[model samples]
Target chain A: MKKTPLNQVHRELGARMVDFGGWDMPVQYSGVIEEHLAVRQAAGLFDVSHMGEVEVRGANALAFIQQLTINDAAKLVDGQVQYSAICYPEGGVVDDVTLYRFNGAHFLFCVNASNIEKDFAWMQQVLRESALTDVTLTNRSAEFAQIALQGPKSVAILAELTDVSLDDLAYYHFCEGAVAGEQMIISRTGYTGEAGFELYLPASAAVAVWQKLMAAGAPHGLLPIGLGARDTLRLEKGYALYGHELSRDISPLEAGLAWITKLDKDDFVGKAALVAQKAAGVPRRRVGLVMEERGIPREGYPLFAGEREVGFVTSGTMSPTLKLGIALALVEPAAAGLDGELEVAVRNRRMRARVVRPPFVK
Target chain B: MEFPEELKYTEEHEWVMVEEDLAVVGITDFAQDALGDVVFVELPEVGTVVEAGKAFGVVESVKAVSDIYAPVSGTIEEINDDLVDAPEIINTSPYEDGWMIKIRMADAADVDDLMDVEAYQALIAEES
Candidate 1:
């Protein structure tokens, strides 16, 4: 299995290691709930170096990205980030990505780790079919390492290190700045729905940056979180994970990403199919479920309303903050479109659950 | 981490303490440590018959749902109902308050099939 640059550091911290997406990564440190609560109460630092990055540069970067992704890259100014998805021509999702626009001519695509190779190949295939000669595609995942410092105390802890104007760096915006004596892309962004920063640096700088942040954040109770808490934290915010929420057969609209699927824009991959799907009404919709009773809903668990099966759970977990089971499920739009009661088959028995909009904690 | 010498152990990491025909059962400290932040536990109801090596209940951590297997064939005489609402005790006190069930053993000789503290310790060492 592949290992990130901080594998040794995680081992040093005695984090329980697990195989995650073919990578040997820490699943927790101290414990999942404790580390999760720490992020909510104070601050938590995460090693996000395993996530992949692709650099797209040249004369027609914006146009190439606009055709390649679902979101409108034309709207992105320099040093701005846009949450986007690359879709199959048939309207299903190929990969969800975070597009960082350096300028009209240069851009970076931050993609999910497991889909790195596939995403690059797909992009290359699209560019080849489109016959765009001006665009350059480079997989830069191995060249970068990223870290996220998130929570209520994030600003205070990061203030002790970086010279960047965090105030000016609006959410979803980024800037090229010096942090801890190293040049890095300082972004006011994170997977956790909290005040945070994602620092993108050279792979070689990962250890120093992580060590420095851990030291600076120690007084503020910043814990080195692992993949387990990361899942719960993102689920708490209703963020769509690539494989779980959006997959090759799951469209962005069905995954509750209609806002990012710019159907009104000029022709892009999957736009025709998405527009047709919208016109015909989406067959299924992604919705949130909070257990009204005792059981913890798990992935692939069937959901029902009365005798009719509505859908199945994509991801579910016990919310560390709410102390209740919360889940994201894809269900028949006609049945689960409204906020109402549903039953989740936890195993042998059906458990009472209610459909609630996400951000389950707040 | 703690292995009481008087307790008999199963390879599945359950500890059984036999007193007369009745046995108190709970997961080992190693099991709870492996399943971090246990959030919910589902135990068989009283009077339910169980077979050895079969899954009778489930223990859920934040990220996974794992079955708790029966270590010996018997009927569940009593269960730790407190675990329904406070499952983290499995992590905090797996041996004491976290004891999962009491079984009226079908065959008292079943206890003899289990390993003692030293053997259980070696088993966990090999597995880990």
Candidate 2:
């Protein structure tokens, strides 16, 4: 298993470690609910170093990315970020990524850890096929260490550590700054639906930066968050996890990402298929479900509308914030209506569930 | 971290307090610590028959769901209804308020087959 730069720090903090997508990551430190609540009410810090970063640079960077990703990368200005996905020719998702545009000639793609190798290889192959002479692709996954400081108190905690005016950093925007005396890319973006910043620094400077942030955040009760709470926080906001909500066989439109999939963009991968699918209408739609019964719905649990099996849950949990059994399921479009009643087969018995719009907590 | 000296323990991490012909059952502190923030619990109804070494109910945390095993064969006489609303009490007070069920023991001798506090501590130490 691959260990992040903060692996020892997590172990020292008494975090429960788990194998997450072949990476040794902390699943929880204090506890899932407590850490989750801390992020909701106060603030939480997270080690997100395991996520992959790929740099696409050169004269054709904008053109290359625009053709490679589903979103209109040409719309992104320097220092701006766009949530986008790479799709196969058939319209199924390859991976959802965050495109960080430094300039027309330099772009950074932050992808999921599990899809690093696959996405990198795919990009290389596509670039080779496109015959883009000026473009250069580099997988810089191991060179960076990233941390997310998230919550209502996130800005205040981060403000104590850096001279950068965080007030000026708009959402989905980034700036190069010095934090804890180390050069880092501070981005006002996070998976958790909170006012947060993701700081990307050199791998060797991770420990010092983490300690400085921890010290600064301690007075405000900033707990070190782990993957367990991270999952719940994102799910509460209806954020799509790569493997669960978006997959090789799942189209972005079906995954509630139609807004990001720009069909009007000229000749991107999967454009034709997505256009056809949009015209035909998607067969399945992702919907939020709150369990009416006591059972916790789990991934792969079958969903039924009346007696007909409609779909299966993609991600489900006993929501720490809502105190309810909430889940995300991809069901037949007809069964995805709000307030519609559905049954989830949990532990072999059908449990009552109601279709509701996410974010489940808010 | 605490293991009551009077209670007997199962290898699966359940604690049983033998009281005459009945036994009050709950998970151990070590078990609760490992489970992390119990969010939901599914308990068997009173009068439900449970067999020794078989799963009787489930204890769910935010990250994982675990089965609570029956330490001794018996019929459930009572259950801790308080756990259904605030399952987190299992993390705060695993041995006392978090007790899952009380069973009318089918055989009093089954308690002897289980490990005492000292033996249970040794078991935990060996695993760690």
Candidate 3:
């Protein structure tokens, strides 16, 4: 199992450790509920170095990215990032990644940890097909450490560390600056659907920055959070995870990620099919369902419209904020209307659930 | 980690406290700690009869769900209904107010199979 740079710090804080996608990471520090509530009300710190960062830089970097991703990379500004879906030729999603336009000739793709090896290999194979010169693909994931300070007070805590004013950095924007004399890239992007910043720096300087943030932000109630709360928090905000909300069989259009898919852009992998799907309207879509009965719905549980099984849950959990069971399920578009409810089978019992939008808790 | 000397423990980490002829049962602190936060509790009905070493209830946490086994065979007399609304009490006080059910023991001989404080501690140490 892999351990992050802040593994020792997590242990010292009495975090409950669990194996998360082969990384021996903290599942919780105080508790899932408390840590989750803290991020919603105050601020929480997360060691997210487990996410993979791959650098793709060459003279034809823009051309390579345009061909490799389903979204148009040419539209992104130098300091901005765009969320895109990379796909196989058969129109199935390989991975959902954030394409950061560092410069004209350079870009960084932040991908899910579990899909790192597979995504890297796929990108390399695709890179080989293009005429991009010296398309230097480097995996600097292990060399850099990332910390996400999230919630309402995150900007205040991070503002004290860096000289660059965070006031100018809008949502989804990033700035390269120095924090505590160490070089860092601070992005205003987060998975928890809260105001926050993801700071990336050298692995050697990770622990020191963590300690500095904890000490400086302790008075404002910044807790060292874990993956358990991370899951619940993201679920509340309706964020899609790699294995749960996405898979090799799921397409970006079916997953409600068509906003990221720019079919109008010049040629890209799976663009033709995606544009066709968009034009024809996708038959199956991912939607949110909230249980009205007394049972907690879980992943892989069957969803029924009357007697016949219409769909199955991809990700489901009891919402801490709403005090109700909610799930994301892929159902036939005809059965996914906002006008009615469905039944979700939890174990032997079936619970009444309403088909809402993507975010049930939000 | 607290193990009352008079209480009996099951291998599944449930503890039974005998008061007269009735036994009040709940999961151990070690079990609650391992399970993290308890989100939902499915308690057996008040009049349901359960067999020794069999599941009588279920405890669902944020990540997974686990069956709560009966330490001894008996009819459930009472249950702590407060856990239905606030299951975190199990993590805060697993041995006391968080007691899951009260059962009238059908046979005292079933208690002999359970572990005492020392035996349970040793069992946990070995597993850890």
Name the top lDDT candidate.
Answer: 2
Position A82, candidate 1: lDDT: 94
Ranking by lDDT: 2, 1, 3
> Compared with the true structure, what per-residue lDDT tens digits does model 1 show for residues A1-362?
99888899999999999888888999999999999999999999998889999999989777788899999889898989999999999999989999998888899999999999999999999988887778999999988998999999999998888887787889999999888888999988899998999998998989998999999999999999999999999999999998999998999999999999899899899999999999999999999999989888888999999999999999999999999899999999876755788999988899998888887877
lDDT of 1: 0.91
lDDT string for model 2 (A1-362, tens) is 99999999999999999999999999999988889999999999999999999999999988889889999998899999999999999999999999999988999999999999999999998899888889999999999999999999999998988899999999999999999899999999998899999998999999999999999999999999999999999989989999999998999999999999999878988999999999999989999999998878989999998899999999999888878899999999999999999999988589999999899977
DockQ of each: 0.95, 0.83, 0.81
Q: Output the better candidate (1/3) by lDDT.
A: 1
- Taking the tens digit of each residue's C-alpha lDDT, what string does model 2 give over B1-128? 79989899999999999999999999999999998888889999999999999999999888788999999999999999999988989999999999999999999998888999899999999988
lDDT of each: 0.91, 0.94, 0.88
Worst 10 residues of 2 chain A by lDDT: A317-326
Error of 3 at A158 (Å): 0.6
Task: Choose 1 or 3, whichever is better by DockQ.
Answer: 1
The RMSD (Cα, Å) of candidate 3 is: 1.5
The lDDT, on a scale of 0 to 1, for candidate 2 is 0.94
- Between prediction 1 and prediction 3, the one with superior TM-score is 1
Q: Alpha carbon lDDT of residue B111, candidate 2?
A: 89
